[model samples]
Target: MKQIFTFLILGLGVCSGVQAQVDAVQKLDAVILSDSKLKNYAAGIKIEKLTDSVLSNNATSLTNLLAFNSNIYFKENGAGMVSSPSFRGTTASQTAVIWNGININSQLNGQTDFNTVNTSNYSSIDIRSGGGSVQYGSGSIGGSIHLNNDLKFSNHAETRIKTGYGSFNSKNLGINSSFGSEAWTANIGVDYVDSDNDYKYLGTDSVNENGEFHNLNMNVNLGVFISDKDILKLYHQSYIGERNFSGTLVGPSRSKYEDENFRSMLEWSRIIGKFSSRLKVVHLHEMFKYFENKDKDNYSLGKVNTLLINHSFNVSFNEKLQFKTILEYSNSKGNGDSFKEPVRNVFSTTALLNHKPNNSISYGVNLRQDFTTGGERPFVFSVDAGFDLFEHYQIQINGSKNYRIPTFNDLYWQPGGNLDLVPESSYQIDLGQNFNYPNFNVKLNGYYINTEDMIQWQPNSTGLWSPINIGEVASYGAEVEVKSHYNINEHQFNVSGHYSYTVSEDLETNKQLIYVPFHKGNLALAYNYKAVTVFYQHMFNGDVFTTADNLEGRFTSLNGYDVGNIGCNYTFFKNTKNELETGITLKNIFNEVYENVAFRPMPNRNFNIQINYKF
Candidate 1:
């Protein structure tokens, strides 16, 4: 795999030198934006929007686009190493990752490494599921993932490029650009990935030793209008990663890891007459390094920094009332070789209300409060409702209260830190149903959760390990979704799918909960026949136990699998400016002998090839 055919022949010689600067610009077709504060206060919460052709067909990572399109489970330790996520059955520090409206997790380990993100640097990707910490603060209890940036003004300009080559010697590159005027606007994204993941081990013959990895990502967005009621915004993101720590079919290793992240934000908005205002400022940075012996240069370091401020106000009061208010502040600092006191501060306030007295019905209410320097200060709330029972039916309901605090190595780890830990609470509820026709759509949901003081790190009586407030947990779930679209004349069709059923428990040893997966599902299909397209995807997972007492022999458990993938694409140089596309894919197909983590072996039957250019 020596540099994978010289980076696929230097990415086809830089796509033939940008195809001679492809002019006559006008090819921007990718849109699906929302997050006007969760579409105006999140009435019955169940968001799941991921488009832009499913983020350019999962342009690799956000854990391969939410484990092949969302019912989230992922535990990965190989094949790009370390990825985590479990949402709905919670834990990965209770899932939350939002950007472009703050809360970027990890103040020294609250979580968020979905393989260092990079889903082609985002331009909208949302997934909201149960409880959201009264609008994203501390680990939004089992749900929350949004990353957005969309701006538009008037005239336009564009550029796009992508390249890929795959299977064990993987490679990728991407670039995007945008421009607009009338006031101003901008967007940019960049991505790069590499892998030499080694692969092999299905029934064992070794290989996959020091699994390699690489990453880089960048994103930026800007906007300005500043006059007929002022507006301004800016955002930036960056990430860098490195990896090598895979070796477990009976060991032979040399650990290594490195990480870096940065984020910045600024915003302002205004309008007066019935009030509408917003202001935000944010900054975040994280760092990490570790090396047990990658030729021994010795390593161990950690760092964290955060600063934030936010303000919001909105009002309507008529045509069916509305209101919003928020204020927030934060400061965090951490340093490490296993901390021993590193600063924290927080303050928060929020309130929201919405009502609709027409078109069947709607409702929302949310509240939050927190103030901390030391531990628990929480008070949160949420209530949601919606209904419209005919002409395609709908109904929804929600409830919430969520919290999580204590990180910085669980409050200053030094031989086992834990100076009185508290703050882990949860309570949740959700129920929903929806149906629509004309081209079909359906959704259904059910949920429940209860948790309290549930933190654990065990080992006492002189065996060090700290962090307490143990035991008590429960989770329940159900979800189903389906979607469809069709056309007959030039032929186009699409379909989508999802399913999940979970049960996470520990209520005093009632078992289950280590890697928790009680079934999961996915499916996708597409067909278009004018410029050619074809696609397919499938996934399923079940049976995961690995010891929290639900164990069963041989390495404890992990046995359930189904995987598939297929692809096609074509669209040669077309009109109205420029375009070129080509594609190929075939992953796992039927060569599946899986492991989500037991001994970590996955990947067989693989392929990929892609190229795209636009202007």
Candidate 2:
């Protein structure tokens, strides 16, 4: 506790220092993604942006980056294993993942594995909290994560290469290159990662064997400016991964997983008078294979393919009133050993209106409807308002309706498939406030979500599992964040912290939900002098119940744990067009023993060193 206070005091001193000598430090232009409807219409939404420096610190995977800095909780089975995120006390399937303006959640399970996404492949990441189904489509009852790739036209060519080594025989290598002119731009990036993951188990002498994985990723982007009124952009990404799944201490040890993912998107934008229009086409394919043992004959294969076409138009009437309309068409097909061959078609439309009477106040309203040939049809809507009360203080209120459709596994499983399950729906409300200053920013938000007719797989009297829409849940949470940064002479200091409290319950049984923590907190501080920098971060997760009934005298309760990490970076060389940097990170400084998921132990203290060069 004393260390935390001292840290805050040091940051406060920097924030209170004189600003006359701060002209030497320049802030980079933040990449503000325009794909979010909330960002364009509302003023005080709960949105967070991860900058380039932060991304560089944790470039291995998106799971590692978000688990430490964000309020979302990630459940991991083991090192280099499958990982998923739970947002705002909602289940994993309720959160949506959008890549380059298209939904990329798996058609089989309705969720994306964060461990499979490489953070180094994208230039920008944005997280928008609260329900966003009105604009982003279904499966957004909690929030949405948006990943973007950019192609900027510049006169100079640049190249970057990095290599790193860590504990458990882990290796990382990456390369990125970009060069373009005013009329055309292009970017290419590639990354490779492999790990043995043979760490020792806590309180035991036995080592976790057969826990190895390898991953490769590639991304390409091109942009063309066809006159001043029109532009076109194309993007492609591919991923290949193979991993050995480590079962429990007493379970099988030879299971393996292999997967391949490919995505392509093309977007065209035009401007005419006060109207702006954009058209996008996307295609995605995923292939997965599972092996029960080392035997080549014992395996299963699954495949899913999806295509999307979307069009959007925005018109501004003067500066106080604006209107936007969007249309989306999608088709999906899947085939697997346990699933029946299924095809689905969907069409959705949305209309939104924004009103800003003055600079201090703003409001927005939107209505959306979705039509599906093989699924439930529903209507969604949202309303939000914001008011600037003072020079740096603001208040915001939002309400929305959201829903999620059953996945392919839930509807088309071979043994107990149920094609009559309807969609799960929810109503959400959010209230928030913000305080912003040159060197300080603070935000507080509270949200309540009431869900009805949730789909769940339950065994009948005959012991056949089937998905049924017979569950209700009520989830509410509060989030608070504070950040400060200052540049004093040649030294810079930054501090950021957040805390969240959530309570999720089963409406019928009045019991807490499983795997949802009640309290979570994070703190981070960084200092930079000249070309050298140092940082430290700490995270805390509260106790969680692993069973829905909250029964005691069982092994279904998980105790909370604390984790701390410290790192330092230094510039080795710098020139007109060349630079080199070296960094080292020490994670789990305390060597804490804990499990995020039942019976899945995490790694202990480990260190990694990285070297990067750019020319």
Candidate 3:
């Protein structure tokens, strides 16, 4: 270990010689896609943007991308395995995942597995924290995450290749290329990763075996400039993977899983008079296979297919007022070993009005209605306003009504299915304040949410669990974020931190909700000198309860823990149009023994190093 550290240091030091001869590399140009329709109508909303740097990091999956914000928490069984995220104090099903302007939640469970999402597939990511059902459809009571690929029309061609080696015999490789002509552009990307995640745990002296995974992803994008006012774009992506499940210390089970997913979309936009219109068609297919070596009866297989057609138009009425309307239609079908075959069709319409009467004030209102083939109809609305009090101070507020429909599993699972279940609905509000300075920025936001007709599974007189809609919850939270930057000659420094406090309680029993943390915080510092950059990050998670009763302190309790990480990057070679870069990251510097999910132990200290070349 000591020799490896010495070699890494020597390698970085040898590359420093080029700092004196090379000029600073220019930043990549930001690509603008037509998918910014939702962002343009939002006021007093908190949105976090994750660039390529945050997406393509040492972390194994998308879980790490959401963890960068203290307000969102991801519960993972372990590295390279199943993971889910909770926003504010809402459940995983309440958080929506939007891929290229379309909701991609599973029809079976109404949830998206973070482990199956590869960050290398997308060029940009955006997270909106609050209810967004007014613009999006159901299953957005908590928040929404958007992954988009930008279609860049450039004059030059570029290619990049990246590879990484890490602990537990982990390996990753990716290739991306783009070429453009006068009126046509094309881009393609491919990524592959495999890992033998047999890391040791605290309770067991021997390393946990049967923890392996393999993944592959490919994407293609094509864009055509139909004149100067009209554009057409097409995208396609596919993912295939297999994983072995690693059970907890108390009970170990031998099982393996396989998954295949494919998605495609076509979009066309045109500018007519003062109105801009866009039309999109999307298709998604997913399949999963589960095998239990010891018990074949417990094995299962399932698949789902979905198609969507959507259209929207934005009209700029002068510069102070704008109106946008959207119409969407969706069809979904699910089939499985135990699930009853079900097909659902849904249609929705939305209208938004925005007004910016003055330079310091802006406001927006939204109204939407959804109709489903099952005869379930829902109506939602939102209102938001923003005020710039002074040059350095600003205030904003927003309120919305949201809803989440029952999943196929909740309504069609053999013995536990309940066809009489109703949709869950929520009312939420948010208030925020911001202070900006030349070198620093500070933001604080507080929110409250109340939900009714919540669904849960409970055992009946027959001693079998069945879905029921007899639950209610009240959730509230506050978040704070601060950022600062400094520069001295050739050296640059950046500091940022965030803290959150949340409370969720059941209205019936007045008991604290399970799995929701009351406190979370993060702090990070970064320094850049010439061609080298270094960063240190720290995180703290409050204790969580596995059961609503909070049983024994050692049994049902998941104690809080603190973790630290340090990393560095170096640009070894650079020219006008080409560059070579390498970096290393060390996680859990102190080797803390902790678990995000009860009974599931996380790995100890780990290290990963990556290299990239672009030309």
Which candidate leads in TM-score? 2
RMSD of each: 25.5, 10.6, 12.3
- Please, what are the lDDT tens digits per residue for candidate 1 over residues 1-615? 323533533343334324323333232213213246677777688888888877777776788777778888888876788778988898887898888667798987798888888877777788898888877877889888898777777778888899898888889888888887867788888888888888787777777878888888888888877665566778888988888888877777798889889898888775555555567888898998989887888898888888988876666667677877677788888888878449899977777788988888888888777778877678888899888879898888889999888788877878787879998999999898989898998889989989888776778998998889876798998989888989999998998888899999988888878888888998989898988988888989888888787767678888888988888989886777789998888888788988788877877778889898988
lDDT of 1 at 231: 69
> Residue 132 lDDT in model 2?
84
lDDT, candidates in the order shown: 0.81, 0.83, 0.81
Better of 1 and 2 by lDDT: 2
TM-score of model number 3: 0.92
**Candidate 2 per-residue lDDT over residues 1-615, each given as its tens digit:** 433533443343333223213323322112213374646865546889887877887877798788777888888888789887879988888999988777788888888989999999898888888988888887888888888886676565899999999999999999999988777788899999999998877876666677899999999998877766567888899999999998765564888999999999888876555666677899999989999885566788888898998877776667898877787888998989989578889887777889999998999988777888877777888999889999999998899999998888888987877899898999999999999999999999999999998888889999999988877899998999888999999999989888899998989998888888999888888999988999988888888898776875347888999999999999988897999999999999999988888877788899999999999
lDDT of 3 by residue, 417-533 (tens): 898989999999999998989999898999999999887788999899998887789989999988888999999988878888988889888876778889988887889898998
**Order of candidate numbers by lDDT, starting with the best:** 2, 3, 1
* TM per candidate: 0.32, 0.93, 0.92
Q: Sort by TM-score, best first.
A: 2, 3, 1
